[model samples]
Target: MTEVGILGTGAYVPDRVVSNDEVGAAAAVDDAWVVRKTAIRERRWAAPEQATSDLAAAAGRAALESAGITADQLSVIVVATSTPDRPQPPTAAYVQHLLGASGAAAFDVNAVCSGEVFALASVEGILARSGGHALVIGADLYSRILNPADRRTVVLFGDGAGAMVLGSGRGARVRHISAHTFGELSGLIEVPAGGSRMPCDPAALEAGRQYFTMDGRAVRAFVEDQLPGLVKQFLHEAGVVPDDVRHFVPHQANGVMLDTVFEQLALSRAAMHLSLTRYGNTGAASIPITLDEAARAGAFRRGDLILLAGFGGGMSAGFALVEW
Candidate 1:
């Protein structure tokens, strides 16, 4: 069986950098409070005119350039985003058109923060069973959906995009991936309106239910309790042990969450790759963006073990181990 791997990787953040101090001024917290809570000193917010597709296109082009492939070479383009530019037309088609990838099939994935791992899993399935390359992009302009008045949610989200080219390969390739969801426990966090369950209406807008909300206490407890065991299960299932793993790229949820998981699992920062300090929690884009940055920083070699893990809304989690 031919193995699938990332041929190239790319990521893009908006030019505007909003320091924690800036956000604190609006949200009634200090910079140090934000930093201590999220480990985020700064984050990028999209310009008022910018949208998710714009960031995804930029990241896609960079991935294509790094892969030495043209837009025409892509067999598929999967965009994973929770915040789409329009509620109607899929963002993938818009991105595909902008990139001039006329022949490539395009669609969107909406697994929220677990989106990239899901996109990567989908790509692996397509490539292993067939023979084509895919450009998977995870982009989110989450700030658009945020309620600026809500300190808890708004402070944790930023806008960014990350992409990777996956194709059949021999070295430093994706090997095993899996996804699990606990939909029954989905109430930990979510945007109550804007979807079918509670369609956007004038009433919904007035109530301010359209913005993202989370039970911080619930989230903190869940991560502290469930995440470590989940990581162990994923690594063991992939036939790798904790000691064999080289880089632990987890969902950039927050520093507190990551620190809790690490401490519980007895894992060291030396075993992890992180970008939360600069990127905040970019939802689905977190893992890929972190992966791209780390690779550029000479974080891995061909035989190193790379573990991708995420736990997010829908009470969902995913993990994958790739040889790199």
Candidate 2:
């Protein structure tokens, strides 16, 4: 069987930087308060003209360049996004057109913040069976869906894109992957008025129910209890110990959640990678963006084990063990 691994990686963040001070000003809080609470210093926001597809395309192009491959070589393009450019045409198709990957199959996956891990798992199955290369992109234009007045959720999100090229018969290997979802808890964090369940209406719009609503305290409690077990189970299933893992990249949710999981699992700060302090949470794009930065910084050498875990709406969670 052919092993699948990342051929290249890239990320794209908008030119504009929204610091804690700006958010605090907009929300009637202090910068220090926001930073101490969320551990977010600044985050990138997409330009008004740049949609999710545009962000995905930028990162895709860089991934192709890094892989020394052309767009024509791509056989599949999977974009994971919650905030699509529109409700009809798939964002992945738009990205494919932008990259001129005319013959490639394209589509979008929606699993909220767990999107990238889900997309990667899907592509892994495809790559392992078929003889083709895929461009997997995680992009989110989260600001478009945020409510400026909703300080709790607004402070935790940003806009960015991250991408990786996956191919069969690779030099490095994605050794194992596991993902799970609890649909009963999906309502805990979601846009209540966008889809069939909560169809858009004049009333919904008037009440501002169209934007994202999160039960922050509920989500924190749920994740703190469930994620540690899921991650540990997968690592043991992968036949590796926590100490053997060279890098641990969890979803860039917040410092509190990050610290909770780390503390519960007896994971030292040395075992993890921290990017939320600088980039905020870019949803599905978080893990890949951090992975790309760490890779560039020579954070891992050959034969190192890299552990990735993600949790968010669906109330989904996933874990992957990669050998770099």
- Please report, in order, the local distance difference test score of every candidate based on alpha carbons: 0.86, 0.87
lDDT of 1 by residue, 219-260 (tens): 878777888888878777888777787788889999877877
Residue 49 of candidate 1: its Cα lDDT? 91
Candidate 2's residue-wise lDDT over 164-200, tens digit each?
9999765458999998999999889899887787778
TM-score of each: 0.96, 0.97
For model 1, the superposed segments whose C-alpha errors exceed 4 Å read 268-270
In model 2, which runs have C-alpha deviations exceeding 4 angstroms?
268-270
How many steric overlaps does candidate 2 have?
0
State each candidate's clash count: 1, 0
Query: Model 2 residue 284 lDDT?
Result: 90
